[model samples]
Target: MVPVTTTQIHSRPSLTIIGGGPGGYEAAMVAAKLGAAVTIVESKGMGGSAVLTDVVPSKTLIATADSMRRASGASGLGVELGDEPARADMRVANRRLLALASEQSNDIRRGLERSGVRIVIGQGRLVGPTTVEAVTESGTEIIESENVLIATGASPRELPTAVPDGERIFNWTQVYSLTEVPEHMIVVGSGVTGAEFASAYNQLGAKVSLVSSRDRVLPGEDPDAAVVLEEAFVEDGVNLVSKTRAESVERTADGVRVQLTGGRILEGSHCLVAVGGIPNTAGLGLEEAGVKLKDSGHIAVDGVSRTSVPGVYAAGDCTGVFALASVAAMQGRVAVAHLLGDAVKPFQPHLVTSNIFTSPEIATVGVTEEQVASGKYQADILKLDLSTNPRAKMQNVTRGFVKIFARKGSGTVIGGVVVAPRASELIYSLALAVSQRLHVDDLANTYTVYPSISGSISEAARRLHVHL
Candidate 1:
């Protein structure tokens, strides 16, 4: 492998990015391209959680599930069906996931190199506001830079009472390591991660029991979207336990047993914990560097991604903005632009779109009813169900809807939600509209193909006039 040469290194404003995930690596790329000598320190492989264990692998698995669902729907479209059910090979599917993750990681590393960024495989800690100490396999090296970016990302949140053993009980990051599929999988925490895995495993023929601490599957998502997923999970024979919290999990000889807060018990062949994540901020010298941390232990940053300390900034989940990869990348770019004296827009948390990778994925951008109810926004909401949509009926997808929230007087699209197949893709248009401060009139005026799922989106926008 060709190493970065000393001659190529410059004495200009130097940037050192710690963690080398989407945020770190992307910041390194931006800083390098902007004539800043950049160095990235990475403990794990490139692409971070988005590639190795979280986004890429989970989405790829969802893709396989999608294909299976489509094939099942083929019979409804008058296609022939076989008496035997289709089979999914977990080993083959996992092999493909790993291969894709590796390829993407390599591509990210190569891109950083081509952009004139130096990458060192090590765990980086902040020695000061502008100095990073990297512990590599060879030894430790302290690098001084003009600016530092922390993108250490996060790890799966585990409960002390019910920890993941990585065998019978697994965390979200460890679930992908499975070669053989479990016969019965109990998913604790019915949030985004839990819903996605439950949906995938249910589709893959696993007996799934989804445990939720809230009244619905996706408590934090759009209300209509949550309802749709709850119905879908029920139709697929997924046992939905609402308002139930797993107090503890223990590995049994035959499988696993989970004790609930209310003294209820759930037994399954395996348990996957998807409660949440904790930022990878410990022992990073953050406190010593004078960076302020939030109550939840996430680094506090301004709109420009700058921490309390000058010359030090943070992005991605470490900042706890939206916890979305897209938002993380944008924040990283925003940090670079601001530091490099380039024209930059302040990071807007409201405009970031996020998706939960369930069967009929749920994607939302901007505000929600809960936000409005809680006085976060006083916007009016318009909802359109997919049951009346031609494409949804044709596809045999009976559940899901499109909902949009806009300022009552201005009609500016403050927020929107989509809960249908490819909802992740559909939420982008709304994200753009919200980011650009577009109004309902713009969405209503836009043309959508007849008999398309997106037509419902337009209809939802059109209905906004009634409230106005």
Candidate 2:
């Protein structure tokens, strides 16, 4: 395809979106629908990290891995034992996941094309508030627009010495490249992603070791929710190396060795570095454009996704607002709405909901225990274990619970955590309540389905006033 000449540039309210991830692409579609001539510049595939690396591939792998776990344990529920416990053929699963990832990417590409948005497959750098330079396979092209959306997402952060080679040692994103499952996987970091991979592999018949710098797993999550997840991991036979800091990881001929700060060494067939992701903001002219980045290297944006620089906006992982796909999508929408002077809700970081895709997944919204401790709110908490729920009993699920946090005086539900099977689906009610600041009495008054796990959520809210 011949490159369009600079002379062919049309006059319109042009919107150039950098980084074609969920945030960027979604923003481009919205902008196009709003009659803005849109262009999306991307370094990688259209779906960016979520589709090409993170969300799509991980969830696809999880589906197959979860099925194997269920089949393997079916005998324990009085079902006749299969000839042998079903095993996960990672080679086959990897092929399936890659195909699904490709399909998702294509879907995004087609959707954008059909919406009259131009896609430039290359790196985009800001030349000015309304000018973006894209270096593509064909050649360099400058997109002069009335507005620019910086949606450049984040990349998996690597430890100084534990660089991934896409083989024995790999980051969370590169782990999907493996065609074979590791005999033993040592997951470094106890964060949400780390816990999810550790749990998935352990359930898929891989001996797993989780190294945590903190005293317990998922240290940053709700304390009670973390406790329940730790118990579930232990029950799944995951080797939890808690309070042991990872000094470095090196790959040897036989396996990978993780050296701890206290001089302990843990060996495993593969090492997964899930420490975290760093925003892809550097080398993008953000500094030159006068956009402020936070200490953690994330673009600083206010309530409406407007960055420190005027006429420039950023959203998604670039803004470092919770690092969730849903939040990223929301930020992108708000950024476009604010830019177009349309009716837009102010970005509310506190009300953004997130979920950890682990077994008996952890879903949460609003404030946390640390916030309450820091005097953010005078609140009381109530927790109800799933063991008391009839549906949980029917499903043979015992290791989970729901906890709700509410204002001490007003009884307004401010935050909540659900640690049960399909917790992502069950946490929406809590998310709505937190977003709207619904009172605990409002939840307690509503009726959940009979024999539903979500009953624990309402029951927990009912306990707030009684215990406080």
Q: For residues 372-403, what per-residue lDDT tens digits would candidate 1 score against the true structure?
A: 99987788888888999999998888878889
Cα lDDT computed for each candidate against the true fold: 0.87, 0.87
Where model 2 places Cα greater than 4 Å from the true spot, the runs are 1-4, 7-11, 464-468
Clash count for each candidate, listed in order shown: 0, 0
- Per-residue lDDT, model 2, residue 114, is 99
Residue pairs that clash (backbone atoms under 3 angstroms), model 2: none
Models 1 onward score TM values of 0.95, 0.95
Q: Cα miss at 111, model 1 (Å)? A: 0.7
Deviation from native of the Cα of residue 176 in model 2, angstroms: 1.6
